[model samples]
Target: MIACLWARAASRKQRAGRESNREQLTAAGNGSAGPMSKKTLARPARGARGGTRRRHLTVLFTCVGRRVELIQAFRGSAERLDIDLTVVGADKSELAPALHLCDRRAVTPTVLDPGYVSALVEVVRSEGADLLIPLIDHELPVLSQARQRFEESGCLALISDPGVVSTCRDKIATYRHLKKHGIDTPRTWLLEAFAKRKSRSFPCFMKPRRGSASFGNYVIHDDEELHTLGRRVPEPIVQELVAGFEHTLDVYTGLDGIPRCVVPRRRLEVRWGEVSKGQVAKDPRLMEIGRRVAQSLPGCRGVITIQCIMSARGRIRVIEINPRFGGGAPLSILAGADLPGWIMRERLGEKPRIRMDGYTDGIRMLRFDQSVFLDRRGELL
Candidate 1:
């Protein structure tokens, strides 16, 4: 009887919270109704008096590369909620495929450039973007550091803390952080330390400390190969290679810094370091690891991709953590994670109910390319 009563109370509280959120959204939209002027781009606009208002939210996606599927997912979510979502895609190249699919498109300077953040801010101001989602790995740290600037302009930047970004960007720091948190990660050695010790095991792995896309990653079977690659790859780090099945976990946390969902995808086939074929796994061990990693990084928000290897003996070792959305996140989304919807709801001041067991297991994704057309004049057709 006590448990039933508690369940009833919780359900009532959830309903009340949702009602409050809806009221707040409606009130804000109504109060801000006005002519669609340049100044009005920064926020949602509502209709005056008893007239209907088209409530809209503008979101900016930076470094959008082959992420058309993700943008479409957001669009689909907005349509379901009756929200006018303006998706603005920004990239360094105008020809990026995803750019053509956005409601508005802009070419921004590279993240390495000093003016990258400023340029992005200007785009946000001009487009009236309410949210900014950085898609690329290298750009994550830069945007994370400038998150406050974006927020100050009425745009929320979905990024982890700068410290977490740094740790994820550098493999050496990533291993240290995981081990520090009592998480199992592969044993790693700095290039200099490995050279000095000369006692490292064979069949080790070497990769750039700050690389992405599986670039500069190699399996070193001997000291000679390690030395050769160490000279070729900059800032190389070696790790004890664990032969096992790899898995990628899509961990989503709310702005309150609490993990709300974890979807572990088993990698079946990888092409160019990106998952070309994968399946969602409901393994409890993987879920627990994802939860622990999420809790470890309290400042993490949105989707964090964790890479781990499970040995034949069932020992799990976390290999990498990317604080941004992974290349294979579309698979998890298709498996019913609804991360895009969750993010939109949370940003609208709605507390999304955590559905840890919402996703389907053994659901597979086989990726293929789709074409976009352009005219000779370089305009999208």
Candidate 2:
């Protein structure tokens, strides 16, 4: 496979008018697959008299493409907690750099394939995966539905309920749900509905309603651009253009369906759709909004990534919600909120000590490009 490069961010002055901070840094990432060799399928630890014991956790990621940092973070957390951990990855492509990094890896069908879920479930069962984290949005719905099958096999699929996943997957449904719950989201409409209105707004935002990773997103300057770009996108939705500082909130929830931590990080730069340069803002307002979402979204478990913008007047407008670990979650994990550790500990019947605002503020993540060299035999060099 060829090397993949992430472009360096342009100078601040050059970027001032180039991209909207609001929507450019969405937190979606490539799906991860599962590997084997380490599964926390060990016996339940003893109590106080049981004393502290080392546990094992076999973690699997689906569509595991390029999330090296995330995989490394989980490994680091396990080390700190004295847990025996085996990282497994599942992907259709052997060329995925992160797939090669897993403790074990398996090739699988694409998320769109009818056999995708069955293939993944088989991976979990075979690998003895204790936790399954689905990285791509396209697979979330199917994973949510088959969660029981995973549980029956003693694997915890880290996914929200089917209804919660549906609400987040559809952009139109997201807008309506946020509005109904009294959350401030940008005014949005389907392309057909927005186009029929005679009074049209310029400089609106348009993207495929079911899209991710900022793909097919356009900032329309006029009716001509709107119609032109809208046609180019599949199942487009037009939104009233918003202005403000873009911030992504990484929210972590407990098994009881309650949120325990929320880390608000400001996106300073982005490569593709993931955050390239981000700083932990640790704003209380954003934390409150995250809590509200946890309240509004029933049956929501595990980590949920949210994108939003805040104006000079302190008004916050929510943009999108992703019910999985954000691509930039490494930054928050580094700030001291070990979400992966917490999730595994909880699954192992250990209580995690978490605080809503304990993460370090002002710690910035400045990303750079690195390449993996592989030989003709597909072996890492």
Clashes of 1: 0
Candidate 1 lDDT tens digits, 1-381: 122332343334334434443221111123233322243324323211123554567788999877877776676666666666777788888778877666666777788999888878777776667778999899998899999888776678999999989999999999999999999998998888887874778888999999998999999988899888899888999888998899999998866668788999999999999998999998989998999998998889888999999998989999999988898887888778888878876766556787876888998888776767779976555
lDDT of 2 by residue, 1-381 (tens): 011111111112113323322111111221242343242334432211245655777788988888877777777777678777777788888788776566676778788888777777777766677788989898899999998877766677889999999999999999999999999999999999998989988889999899999999999998788877777999999998888999999999867779999999999998898899999999999999998987789888899999999988889999999998899998898887789888878877788889999888988888887666779977556
lDDT of 1: 0.79
Error of 1 at 292 (Å): 0.2
Error of 1 at 244 (Å): 1.0
| Superposition error at 313 for model 1 (Å) | 2.0
lDDT values, one for every candidate? 0.79, 0.79
TM-score of each: 0.86, 0.87
State residue 248's C-alpha deviation in candidate 1, in Å.
0.5
